[model samples]
Target: MEVIAERRYQVRGMADLVLRIGKPEPFPDGRNFLCPYEIDGPLTQRRSHFGGVDAVQALLNAVGAATIDLELCEEVVQGLLSLHGQSGELGLPDPLALTRLRSAGTIG
Candidate 1:
């Protein structure tokens, strides 16, 4: 199908899509059809979503082997992004700075 569709299904926790095959459409004219084979993204992305592959992996895990909706994926992505720092906006707040502050016990 389309990338948006695939992404949507992934975030919504819908059906799983696995195998994807391109087959010729049985039309008057010979044309190929992209068939998305459904499987299980959730199970597949479990190990992969540990470090930095959370968005894609979560989508896959949510809708294993199923086409997902990009919009939904965007929403999920935003949620994930919000979990990083106090503001939840990309990048981790200087771990070294935090370490120094923690070691000092207090900031002036």
Candidate 2:
């Protein structure tokens, strides 16, 4: 999964992205695809849109235009970047594994 931060040239702030991508391709609008993902801008809640600059941007855009919170968006971006960096690392536990461990009281 390739996540890119969506920039609102006219506005500010960002949000999280969860995507269901297929494969890389091109579109009629000149947007390239690594997978099929979309988000528009900040709103009261997350809304789905397409043709974002990247994952972060898609997520931020998905958030809609009604609500734009810079701190929250930046925080989410950092968290996602951290997770992205941890991906495929040998010692790191996956989210499900961490959840299972916490549930079993093996980790807190």
Q: Which candidate is the best by TM-score?
A: 2
**lDDT by candidate, in order shown:** 0.31, 0.35
**Per-residue lDDT for 1-108 in model 1, tens only?**
222332212223434322231221222233322223222343333211111123343343333322233213333354431222322232223425655897899875
For candidate 1, the 10 contiguous residues with the lowest summed lDDT are: 45-54
What is the TM-score of each predicted model, taking all chains together?
0.18, 0.19
Off by over 4 Å in 2: 1-48, 65-108
How would you encode candidate 2's per-residue C-alpha lDDT over 9-94 as one tens digit per residue? 11223343322222333445666322333333233233333345554444433333212232234333444322234521222224
Q: TM-score of model 1 relative to the true fold?
A: 0.18
For candidate 2, give the lDDT of residue 5. 32
